[model samples]
Target: MARLFNRTTQQGSRTSLPMATTLPMTLFMALQSRKTRYRSTLVVLAVLLCLSTYLLARSSSSASHTLLHKDMPSDDQMPVVFEEASHSHVSGTARKHRKVHKDREQVTLDPSQELAAISSFLASLPQNVIPLSVDPSVTVDPQLVLDFDTRSPRAAAEVQHMVADVWLRNPVFLYSKLYSPASREVKAMLAKMDLRPAPTIIDVDIRDDAEVLEPIIKRLSSSSDLPVLLIGGKPVGSMKEIRLLDKSGELRKLVAASGAVVDGSKKKQHKH
Candidate 1:
């Protein structure tokens, strides 16, 4: 009976040892499977993070490129606009200068036309306005005398003393042929002015005294013209220069300086 009890206890101990070994193996396998699942989850999270970073970087680059393009003007359009503005400014400046030049040209006068106008004015004078001859008997101021060549045509002689009354109250010496359209115009201009004394007229024949007349005319003018005004024993210029001086108000001062009396009242009247 004792032997039977000992055999039964040994069989139970062997069965308990097998059960403990199997439990430890099963627990180790379960731990290994849990570690594998954790590794797979970490790999999937890393991939998602990398994809998200790439997408964010691409979007940022695209936005920067769009902003750059929007801020700057196109190369072709910019140059064309600037060039057109520059050309328009230059053309406007050039046109202004041309207009100013044209205005200056319009105010200028022709020399020939001025001379023709003077001639026309002389032809319109009244026929009855004849200059009186200078009398040798009267004592006259030599400075006031306007000398003329006697050899000129009779028409030239008629106009020599026309302005003598107004320009000089003393006397005018006429050589034959001293009359001309210029002289007539000068005389008519003088006659229109208020003067004190009518100028005395004297006629001298150049044929009789050519030697005396030649020196006088040469001293007064470069050419042997019909009429020459001598003031203070000096030549004043031709009719054109006289007209210029008169218009400028310089002739009155010059004549007054030469001991010729100008009508102050007439000058004031003309100014008004």
Candidate 2:
């Protein structure tokens, strides 16, 4: 009985030692688990802080970019907008200039058209009558004198008619010698007068009366020159002198002073 009791006690002591060892191991394990949980929590908090900082930095950068863009003009819009504005201004100016040019053209007369109208009016006159005529006694101006031979009556009549038509003044015709050598000079003078605007002419054929012209020829110092031009009873040179006066614009004033209507349209046509 004593031996059984000692063995049982030893067994009970062994069981108690095992229980204490188990309690220490369980406590160490619980502390380790708590430390691991704390470390995990700290890691999670650090990660969250880093993510929040990153997000804040990104948001600030985005906001700064947006503000920079809003404060300045866009590169794409600057040139296009300004160019369109400039073009509009230039176009408006050009249109105004074009309008002025068009108005000027509308008001200005065409030179060719005016000339044509004047020509049409002149062409519609009677065959034998002059365009305009004035009586010599009505005005105190000079009378244009012409001496002609009537041997060729047709030629002499034609010259008289031309002088009447062009000068717009009546001419006096005088019958002169038909057989004289001076008659050839009279024919030559008539030929020259036909080519130009005629003047007031006085025709004198000496063949009708030699006694009437002998003293007049001697006074003129004309020798054999049968055709003579006299202005205001004084001998003016010839057809050449008349042509020079007309070319120098003196003829218009001279004729106008004598109550002759000098047509400017005719003068321009003669120049052309």
Candidate 3:
């Protein structure tokens, strides 16, 4: 009975050693599986982060491109708009210049037209307007002699006599101011031309009654300019009119009509 019991105990010891080794091997395998699962989870998270960043960058680039394209104008339309703006600016500037040019043109008159207008106005006056002159040497104040409508009955009689004096002279009278540039120009032009009867220049500014004489001259010529011309007791015009008439050869004709020979030396040839 003792020998059988010993054999049974020996077999149990060998089986128990094998079971303890198996338990340690099983625990090591389970730990290695858990580590592999954690590594896999980290790899998946890294890949997802990289993919989301790429997508976000692409979307932002596309949005920026869209905004830039929408704000910018097309190349074809730029020149047309620029030209329209330029034309508008030029037209406004030209309009202002044309208005100024038109005003200047209206103020300057033609010689023939001015002469005809003055002649018509003079002929329309009453026949008994100017009576016979009094004394040729009498010195009458211009204010008293020219005041036909404003002054007393004696003033009207004096104006009539003065008008008669001016009418009877039949002179080429030039009513001018001393310091006027237009008057100087007219005088220079006349000096060059050969006229039979010399032009009579009246410098109103140098007169004793300058203020009084100036208005009277203006009323007679119906102009607010100096250097008014008169041919055979008829009002001719100013500097501009004379210049135009001279250019057209009408100045010589008018002078001849007024009984004044122009360039008489040229007409008379020297004997050979």
Candidate 4:
């Protein structure tokens, strides 16, 4: 029996040069019990790797998309890409989007500036009324004349009455109606204003050009010793200077406030 026990202990103690190492009982038992969990973990990891690869391939399909993805700017890096544009530029849709944004920033949105510009444009038209606010405290100089040579039929009549009402009442302000008579249209029209003629009417007919304008200028400048403003060859008044612009009213009011007078007339009477 002692000889049999000695042989059994030697067999158990001897380590063998086996193909695979044998696990201890505790480790072997744990692996055997959790075999299903280990298999499931491996399968899930393989699926995640395959999905990530497929998504990357799908995003790089287009050439532009591929370029955008490569060397992309992160929040911690530069945002703008300013590469020299090759002959091949950005898509037409991208250019149009940039232009639309630029034009929106350039447009002026103020409502009052638009309205004032329109009003000033309309006021410059023929027969458009100008409200003459006279400080009657200013004694009128008889040398300054308001002359009308408007070619429009309605304009001549409208201007005649407008100037007369203001000029005739003043002690020294005077007015005259000067125009061509080649047309019976003008003659028939002038007959309407004379319906209530005052002694203060001075009518001059010019068949020639600004030869008529020259004399009127000479008369006003010689008589008043003041600057004369002409409108289409008719002497309008004594003014320091005339400026032509889209918004003459603002400038005119500025001049008036500074005690300087301005005439909006387009023509300038020749100064001797």
- Clash tally, candidates in order: 11, 13, 0, 0
Error of 2 at 257 (Å): 49
Candidate 2 residue-wise lDDT, 181-262, digit = tens: 5444544443433322333333334222234334344333333444543322233344466457656766445544544334
Error of 2 at 5 (Å): 1.6
Residue 269 of model 1 has an lDDT of 82
lDDT of each: 0.43, 0.40, 0.55, 0.33
Ranking by lDDT: 3, 1, 2, 4
| Cα distance off (Å), candidate 3, residue 162 | 8.7
Task: Summarize candidate 4's per-residue lDDT along 160-224 as a digit string, tens digits.
Answer: 45443433232121223354222233233223223222112223233222233234324433334
For model 1, the superposed segments whose C-alpha errors exceed 4 Å read: 1-178, 197-215, 219-221, 264-272
Lowest lDDT 10-mer window, candidate 2? 140-149
Candidate 1, residues 172-211: lDDT per residue as tens digits? 2222233457666656555544333332222223233334
* Candidate of highest lDDT: 3
Best-fitting candidate, scored by TM-score: 3
- Cα RMSD of predicted structure 1: 26.7
The better-scoring model by lDDT among 1 and 3 is 3
lDDT of model 4, residue 203: 33
Q: Higher lDDT: candidate 1 or 2?
A: 1
